[model samples]
Target chain A: MSSVDRSQRSNSTLKTLNRVFVYTILIVSSLMMLIPFAWSVITSLKSNENVFTHSAFWLQFPPDFSAYKEIWNRIPLLKYTANTLKVAVIVTFGQLFTSSLAGFAFAKMKFPGRDKLFVIYLATMMVPGVVLLIPNFVIMRTIGAIDTHWALILSAVGSVYGTFLMRQFFLSFPSELEDAAKLDGCNPFMFYWHVLLPNAKPILTTQGLMAFQFIWNDFQWPLIVLNSESKRTLQLGLSYLMSEYYTDWTLLMAASVLTLLPIIILFFIAQKNFIQSFKLSGLKG
Target chain B: MKKNRERSPRVSLLAKNKIREALWGYLFISPNFLIVLIFTILPVFFSSYMSMTDWNILSKPNFIGLENYQHILQDEVARETFFNTFYFSVLSVPVSLILSLLFAVFLNQKIKGIAFFRTAYYIPCISASVAVSLMFMWLLANNGLINQMLTSFGLGPVKWLTDPKIALNSVIGITIWKGLGVNIVIFLAALQDIPPELVEAASIDGANRVQQFFKVTLPLLSPVIFFVTITGVINSFQSFDLVYNMTKGGPGHATTLIGYYIWKQAFDYLHMGYGAALANLVFFAIFILTIIQWILRKRWVYSEE
Candidate 1:
């Protein structure tokens, strides 16, 4: 009995030690993860004199707001930001509308060739975005959309991933809701607009937030499509800030901070939903 | 007019409703179908044909058949890019998989301040890849923070980006760093899906912590592990953004992975045909890998009884 009691006491100590170890690891790793961003933020706030040094983030009690003002004045940052906002908003709403409607169709409606078509859509997603670059460029050029936001907006408006996400959500929905809507003499579009869409807030939020994140952060497609100075997105603007002409580290960092501002705000505002959707999508995958 | 296109059978209410539902379904999916057909579907065929031509984005693509394919075989730069891509994926995917799984296991503990840790980690993932790359560009510079920290420790400053030998590896490190949070969350979600009773059962059966983790926990996490692996492979292979922003495949083309190479070939040098061919090759390789993984999943993934 004494031996068992001693072992149990030792086990409790071991568990406590394990808990401490876990906390230590988590703290260290989170710090490591945050340092780059923190450094960027610090660099953005620092003066140009000692911007590259270790003391830049520390010695300065209050950081200078000069770089933030300079980045905006030097570059058409507000314009670039407006461009990015326009595209991201349009693309997000566009994807949400198109994908949700199609998702409802795929999930709730019985149509000929439904399964086959959805399967084809799934298969097409495996085609790497890189493979589409040359051909899409040619297509965009052919349609006279080069150096325009239309190139970015048009190609991105249709997304199979969003559709797949919404389809998965709608598949789990009960058919009884649809039957009740139909009993009230609702047409298909009315049922979709009134009953289905009202209940689809959760899925729509998930898809919209994801779409916004994706479009806002997208760099490659914008790089390929847009070239005119006035039409540059925040990503291109940031890249321009980092270009050979401008080696202003603080300026670029400032641009990055501004670029990250909206997303960071969005993440905080929608943090719960964002994390929840991520977990759900992870499970779905 | 639309009704005339389809045979209107004025039969039972159910049949008519089915027809109406089908028509509505068709209408609902039309916008998506058109876009998919134009942007996604058409490109596959257009690019495949473009791969056989010598299109310079100027004149009409002159059909040159398998010549582009032949050139890609002999092209030393293409070979290097392919090798770099393979090297990046081979290193990055496994390291990330293991690290994410380990952290995820530790994080699965119901500790106070777990949400804060999760948010902190996810902050990197939320930022634009370009932004992350830009931050790291300075961070990994010779006189940057990392080397500064190293110098304080009495170690020599290593060139993180410029050196040919270490540039791709540095990019790989950055890739893993930015991606670790999302992967951890994924694994965390998967870990949470496991029943506590299973772990309890393992513990009661005289299994230690490590044993419980390996025996009971791992099998359940296999599906997510595989999912991460496939995505990791795909992302690493097509990892253009970081390289584009950080190194621009510089230092003697050392960091030029296939995606960057394809872009340079098609857009920069106007070797659209060769670019298309290289893109196809990547697609084919990824396609094969995905199929192989799908087939092999049954071997280890725990299917429900």
Candidate 2:
């Protein structure tokens, strides 16, 4: 009894020490992650001369909104914002439809070359996306999609990662549901539409959030495919802005801040769903 | 007459079954296949053909078989760029993986307020790469945040983005900072999935916490670790957004990655065929790595069922 008590005492003490250490590390790392964002927020509001001369972490006076005004004056923020939203929404829809359909085929179908087809699908994922850039652009030009949103939308339509994620989610769902639907006079199409998709809401939401986040922030493809000033996505617009006024840090930070707000807001609204899906998906894998 | 009628109806029913099944399957899959055919497969084949041609955007592609590949094989700049990228991948992947795993292990404990910490780390992952890179450009530059801190401590202000020698290393540092959160979340999930009973059994067998971690936890966690490592390599090799925003292949091509090199050739220099050749190389390299990993996956991943 005494020996057991002694060990319990030591274990409790050890746990206490461990807790302290863990919290210390977590707090420091979290601060490190947050400081850049905080700095950006501060810099976006700083005066031009003070921003370059003063310490990055502190303010000289009450924060200014002049930089935001400058950013608005310099570019078509509304137009670029609209362009980003359009591309993201279209791509999200395309990915959802195509990826879910492909996932269904992999999870349920008993076609002649089913396994082989799935393997091919997985294999395409191994190919680095950069390799597809030039070729994709060439095809886009050939199809007369260059300088258009279709170029961006079409290229990402078949997302192997999305298919992979949806397939994993579908595989774990009990086959009995689909079997029941079959016996109840429902076809496979009806089973998927009415039965499966509603149940797959959690995974679908995750995939949608992912698709939105990726497309909204995407830089290179838009830079390459879209030549029109008005059609350029947010990131491309910012890069162009950077080049045009290389020394104007105030305006640059302001434009970046404006570009960041909508996504951040979107994230905040869906954050509960976002964090849950992450934990769930991580556990599933 | 009754038997004949019944038999004929049954045969027709079987035929109907075949038609309906085929139609439904086609209907379900047509949208996916159409887009893939138009976007993915066509471009893949188009790039293959482009690799054998001498096309710039202006002129029509002339069929000069393997000329671009031949040039790529012989080009010193392309060779250096690939090597530089490979080196960065090698350096960054392990560092990010290790750090994230460590962070995850620490976070996996039954503790209060863990979610807040996890979200804080993941915030960087969601931040725009262009913005993050731009932020770092100001943070890491001489007379920037980091340098100013160092100078206050009576150390020299390092040339972070300007000096070719240290520029790539700075990019690596930025990548690890950005990637740490995703890695931790992944590993933490893997850790949580390990049954507590196994750890209890190890403890009953007179194993300490360290011993339990090594014997019971590490082996079980190998699969997740392997997955994270491979994905990390792939991401590092294909890094472009950060490089493009921060360095733009500057300081005499110090931080030029394979993806940036391909971009420069295809878009900027108008060597579409040559860029295709380089892209082909990157594809093959990743393909080979994936194959090697598949061979090793059976040794690590332990399925419950």
What are the RMSD figures for all models against the true structure?
A: 3.6, 2.8
lDDT of 2 by residue, B1-305 (tens): 99998899899998887677656766666677676666666667788888888899998989999888889878988888987888898899889888788788888887688878887888777778888887787677676678888998899999998899999998989988987877887777778889999999999999988999899998898877777777777777678988888889878889998889999998999999989988887877777877877778767656522
TM-score of chain B of each: 0.92, 0.94
How does residue B248 of candidate 2 score in lDDT? 92
lDDT of 2 by residue, A152-182 (tens): 9987877777777777878898989988987
* Off by more than 4 A, model 1: A52-58, A244-246, A280-285, B1-15, B297-305
How much is the TM-score of the A chain of model 1?
A: 0.94
TM-score, model 1 to reference:
0.95
